[model samples]
Every structure is written in structure tokens, then in C-alpha cells.
Target: MDSFVYSVNATVPIFLVMILGGVIKKLNIIDDNFVNKANKYVFIVALPAMLFKDIAQSNVKKDFDISFVLFCMIVTTICFVAIWLLSELFMKDDTMKGSFIQGSFRSSAAILGLAFVQNMYSNTGMAPLMIVAAVPLYNIYSVIVLTFKAKKRNEDGSLIEVSNAENIKKACINIIKNPIIIAIFFGLWFSVLNIKFPVIIDKTITSVASTATPIALIVIGAGFEGRKAIKKIKPTIIGSVIKLILQAGIFLPIAIWMGFRNQELVSILIMLASPSTVSCYIMAKSMNNDEVLASSIIVLTTLFSSVTLTVWIFVLRMGGFI
Candidate 1:
């Protein structure tokens, strides 16, 4: 019961905010153009700022658990590789391959994951460490998958697929220039060097970080397309299942068996079940993948994660794992 209420308190407000965005859009309080610009702003400025602030502020050195971090890295890599290979073998639509793979494995570690932990525990606990371990790999793997599966239109309007070697090279370049990745790097450096910011600069970062999640959620709600989601329903459902269920089902038990509990276990649960990140849609659009599919996955996962995550938390609490 406590777990259920905790889950509701953590997820319901976010769900309501998204619903508010959808309501505003339906009433024509905002239009698609505004949503489009909002997404751009989130991808370019808001998300980066939020990540920088979180990583920079985290006491990573004090809380650094090499074993936990290594486990996260291993699981994230396996998921990314396994999903991409599965998509290659099974997904018929080339256009959806990248988005499908991305939406499947990328967890919302930075935003909703942290929010869930903070709400439930009144502190971030190990969530920031979890982000440090997994989020960079998420961005790196996303770049590779999106780049390799990218297709462009020829003069005659036929699609041209990128070669593997060129895709790898381009992905390497993108990993360097990606704003989120760059921000993560700088944040890690600051944490490592124990850099302190001036009060005004810190306040500026805090203000910018504050805008990241809400604006992204609103934009996601405004741009959501139900009909398009239906068109891509198969992959969308598969990806959601992977994100909200299978990953957790597979990994959470291992975490428990390995003796992680309390805050560490709860953080692992968030890493597994907190829905697909909005960044998936952003990167899919930028990389010329199926943005509709990406957006649909985000919407569906966000809507469903409330229940799924609640169940996980309840089960974990019952079993004395958290």
C-alpha cells in the first residue's frame, strides 16, 4: 500500500502535467509549431543544462560504487546490442529500425527516474550514481543505432541507406558533438575536479535545469499522435514492453541476488522502469528516423509506467529488497 501510494505520488503529477499539455493543445492554446520549437529548445538547451547541473552537483566520488557502476554499464551495453540485433533480424520496416531499437532500451534515467527516487525517499539516493553509470552509454548507443539505420532520400525520391563503416565514423563524430553527451562529460569533469560554481552561476544553472523536464513533457504531450502510434502499434507495444517490463524483470532479480537493497535497489528499479526518455524522440527526429514511432513509444511508456513501476516497487517492498 505504501509502495502504491509512493508510486502514484511520484508518477501521477508528471502524468497530469502531460495531460495538461494535451488538453491545452486540444483547446488550441498551443499549436504544433509551438510544440516543435519547444522540443528543439529542450534538446538543445534545457536537457543539457539539467544534466550538467545534476552531474556537477552529484557527490559521485563519495558515493562511487565500482561494482554497482560496472554492473549498470554491462547491463546497458548488453541491452543496446541485443535490441539492435533483434531489430535487424525481425523488424521489417527499415524506417523504424532505429527508433524501435532506441525506444526499447533507453530508460528515462535523468528525468523521471530521479524524480521517482526523490519523491519516494526525499533524497536522490543512488539515482545520481545510476545516471552517471548508464546515461552516457545510453547516448552513445543511441547515436550508433540511429546513425547506422539512417536513410536519406535520393534525387529520384528512393531511400539511400548508409554504409556500416561510414555510419560508425559518423556516430563517433556525433558522440563528441552531441550536446547532451558534451554536458555529461563536462559535468563528470567538474565532479571529479571538485569544482565549485559562483552563487550567480549556480543559480543560473538551477533555473535552466528547472525547465528541462516540464517543458519536455509538455512538448511530448502536444506533439503526440494517436493515429500514428496505431500505425506503428506493433513496434510501439514491443518497445514499451521491453522498457517497462522485460528489462526490469531480467535485471532487478539479479540486483537483489547480488545484495543490492534499499536505495541502491530502488535506484536500479527506476533505471529499469521509468519509461523511455523524451530524448529518444529528439534524437530520432534529428537522425531522420521515425519520429512518430519514437514519440508514440515515449507517450505509451510514460502512460503505462505508473502501473508497471508501482507493481515493481510493491513486489520489491514485499520481498524486502527495498
Candidate 2:
């Protein structure tokens, strides 16, 4: 009973905030322009600030577990490679192959993951470490699949083919330039060096950090397009199942066998099961992949994950895993 209540308390408010954002959008209180700008703010400023603050303030050197980090990296690599290979062999729609694979494997690790951990634990806990381990690979894998599978078109309606070598180079640049990864880098640096900011600067960072999760959730809600999503329902449901259920179902048991519990288990759960990040849609559209399908997967996964995540948390709690 306690576990169920805790699970509800932890997840319901987050989704409620998203629902509020949707309602606000319906009322035209927040427009696409607002959602776009707020998304940018969350991505480049608020989210980074939050991560920096959490990691920089934590006793990272003491808590750092190389084995745990390796497990995260290995699992991420396996899932990405496996999904992409399967998609290549099986998916009939070439345009959808990239979006399906990307949407299936890439999670909302930084945004929804951190929010859940913080809500339950009152701190970021193991999430920063998980982010450092898995997020770079997520972005790199996304770039590779999206680039190689992308169907580029000229303004005059001609196809443009990109070389594998060019795709590899672009993936490298994107991984290096990713803002969240950069923030994690600096956060680790600050923690290792025991760096301290001035009081005013620290407080300002705290304020900005505080806005990251809520605003990001709101932006996700406001940006959602239900009508666009319905067109891609078949692929959307498949991708969502892979994201919010199958990944966790397959890996959580393995993680248990490997002896992860509590904060570590929760972090792993979030990594494997959270909704497809909003960035998936942005990346698909930018790379000229199937943005419609990407949007559909995001919408479906985000909507379903509310209930699915709660169930996972309840089970985990009942089993004393978290």
C-alpha cells in the first residue's frame, strides 16, 4: 500500500504538470512560439544548470562506480545496435526505419529520468552518473541511424545521398557539441576539483535549475500534436511498447541478477523505460527522417509512460528494489 501510494505520489504530479501544459495550449495561453522558446531554454540553460548543480554539489568521487557506469554503457550499446539491425532487416518503410529504431531505443533519460529520481529521492542520486554513461551514446547512435537512413531531398524534389564517412563525421561532431553532455563534463570537473561558485552565482544557478523539469514537461505537452500522431498509430504503438515496457522488462531482471538495487535500480529503470525524448522529433525533422512517425512515437510513449512507470515503480518498491 505504501509503495503504491509512493509510486502514485512520485509520478502523478509530473504528468499532471504535462496535462496542465496541454490545457494551457488548448486555451491559447501558450502558443507554439512559447513552447519553442521554452524548449530551447530548458535544453540549453535550465537543464544544464540543473545537472551541473546536482553533480557539482554531490560527492561524485566517493559515489562513482565504474562497474555500474560500464553496465549502463553496455546495455545502451546493445539495445541501440540490436534495434537498428532489426529495423534494417524488417521494416518495409525506409523512411520510417530510422525514426522507429531511434524512438524505440532512445529514452527521455535526462528530462523525465531526473525528475523521477529527484521526486522520489529528493536529490538526483545515481542519475547523473547514468546520464554520463548512457546519454552520449544515445546522441551518437541517434545521429548515426538518422543520418544513414535519412532520405534527403533537394528544393527541386531530388534525393541527396550522403556517404557513410560523412555520416560518421557528423555523428562525432554532434556528440561533442551536445549541450547536456557538455554540462555533465563540467559537472564532473567541478566535483573532482571541488570547485565552488560565489553565493550569488550559486543561487542564480539554483533558480534556473529549478525550472528545468517543469518547463520541459510543459513544453512537451504544448508541442504534442494528437492528430499528427494518429496517422502513424501502428508504428507508434510498437515503438512505445519497446520503449516503455519491453526495454525495462528485458533489462530490469538482468539488473537485479547483477545486484543493482534502490537508487541504481531506479536509475536503470528510467534509462530503459522513460518516454522518447522530444529531441527525437527535433532530430528526425532536422535530419529529414520520418518526423511524423517520430512525433507519433513520442506522443504515445509519453502518454502511456505515466501509467507504465507507476506500475514499474510499484513493482520495484514491492520487491524492495527501490
Candidate 3:
């Protein structure tokens, strides 16, 4: 019951916010122009600010776990690479390759992961360590896959490749210039240096950061088309199964056998089983990948994670693993 409530508290509000956006759109309270501009703002400014605050506030060095971090990094990289390869071989739709790979492997580590662990243990525990290990790769690999798979519709109504050698160079430049990535580096720098922001400046940053997720979610909801989701049903199911079940199914036993327990184990579970990150949609849409598929994944995963997460928590608790 506690697990269920925790999952509800963490996930329901997100769903409600999205539903609210959808309702407003249905009422014609906001236009397509507003949604497009909001996505851009969230991607370029608000999301970066939020990530900067998250990383900068975390005490990465103090709670660092080398073995744990290495394991997470290795597994995350394997997931990313394997998913990309599978998508390339099986999914003929090049536009979906990036979104599929991202949705399959990227967990909501920064937001949902922290919330779950903190709710379960009354503290963040190893959540920060998990973020330190996984979040950077999430952003970096997203940039790579999105870049390599990006396509543009030609004047002839056929898709053209955008990832030739020159475009690869451009992708590198874009990755370097990516606002989220830059904010992450800055946050890490400040965290490592133990730099403190002035109270007013910190509050201002917080103000900007707070807009990121809500705005992104709202834009996603506003643009969401149920008919388009039916077209994406197969990939959506594959992505959700990989995200909500398979990845965790493959990794959790290994973590237990490796002797992680209690809070550490719970943190790993969140890293594996939480909903796909909101940032995946932001990055996908910005990089000209399949925003529809990305949004579908986010919606499906978020809607289902409450029940799935509760079950995982109950099992872990029953086994005395957390």
C-alpha cells in the first residue's frame, strides 16, 4: 500500500499536468505556435537551467561509489548500443530510430528516480550517485543517436540523409553547443569546486529551472495526437517493454548477486524501472527525430510506471533487498 501510494504521488501529478495541457488545447486556450515556442524554450533554456541546478546541487564527490558508477556506466552503454543496433536492423523507419533507442534505455533518473528513493528511504541515499553515473551518458548518447539518425524531408517529398561526414562534424559542434550538455558541465564544475551562488542568483536559477519540466510536458500534451499514437503502437509497446520491464529484468538480479542492498538496491531499481525521461522527448523533437513516437513513449511509460513501480517496490521489500 505504501509502495502504491508513493508511486501514485510521484506519477499522478505528472499525468495530471499533461492532461491539463491536453484539456487546454482542446478548449483552444493555446495554439500550435505556443506549443512550438514552448518546446524550444524548454529545450534551449529551461531544461538546461534545471539540469544545471540538479547537478550543481548534488554532492557527487562525497557520496561517490566507483564500483557502482562503473557498473551503471557499463550497463547503460550496453543498453544504448544494443538498442541502437536492433532498431537499425529491425525498424525501417529511420525517423524512429533515435526516439526508439532513447525511449528504450533512458530512465527518468533525475526526477522520478530521486523522488522514489527519497520517498522510500526518507532521503536521497544513492540516487545522486546514480545520476552522476548515468545522466551524462543519457544526454551525450542522445545527442549522438539523434544526430546520426536525423533526416530532413526533401523538396520531392522524400527523406534525405543529414549525417554525412560534414553533418557528422556539425553534429559534434551541436553536441558541444547543446545547452543541456553545457549546463551539465558547468554544474559539475561548480559542484566539484564547491562554489556557492548568491541567494538572489540561486533563486533566479531556481525560477528558470522550475519551468523546464512543466513547460515540456505541457507542449508534449498539447501536440499529442491519439491517432498518431495508434500508428506508433508497435514501437511504443517495444519501447515501453524494454524500459519498464526488460532492462530492469536483466539487471536487477545481477545487482542483488553483486551484494547491493537496501537504499542502494532501491536506487538501482529506480534507475532501471522508472518512466522514460521527459528530456528524451525534448531532445528528440529538437534534433528533428520522431517527436510523435517520443511523446507516445513518454505518455505510455508515465501512465504505466505507477503500477509497475509499485510491484517492484513490493517485491524488493518482500525479499528484504530494500
The best-first sequence of candidates by lDDT reads: 1, 3, 2
Per-model CA lDDT versus the true structure: 0.87, 0.81, 0.86
lDDT of 3 by residue, 1-322 (tens): 9789878888888988888889999999999889888888998999889878877887877878898998888889989999998998899887789999998899999877777777877888788788878888888888888888776778898987553786778778888888877888888888888898999999999999998878888888887888988999999999999999899899999999999998788888878889998888888887888888998999999999999989888888898887
TM agreement with the true structure for every prediction: 0.94, 0.85, 0.96
Collision pairs in model 1: none
Output the TM-score of candidate 1. Answer: 0.94
Candidate 3 weakest ten by summed lDDT: 159-168
lDDT of 1 by residue, 157-247 (tens): 8988667788889999999988998899899889888899999999999999899888887877776777877988999999999999999
Q: Of models 2 and 3, which has the larger lDDT?
A: 3
Worst 10 residues of 1 by lDDT: 2-11
Off by over 4 Å in 2: 9-39, 118-124, 285-289, 317-320
- How do the residues 1-322 of candidate 2 rate in per-residue lDDT, one tens digit apiece? 5445655565566667767888999999999888767866776787778778877887678778998999999999999998888777877888899999999999888766766788788888898788878877887888878878888789998888878898788767876776766887898899888899999999999999889878876776776677876877888898899999998999999999999998899999999998888677666766678877886787678767777888898888879888
Residue 69, model 3, lDDT: 91
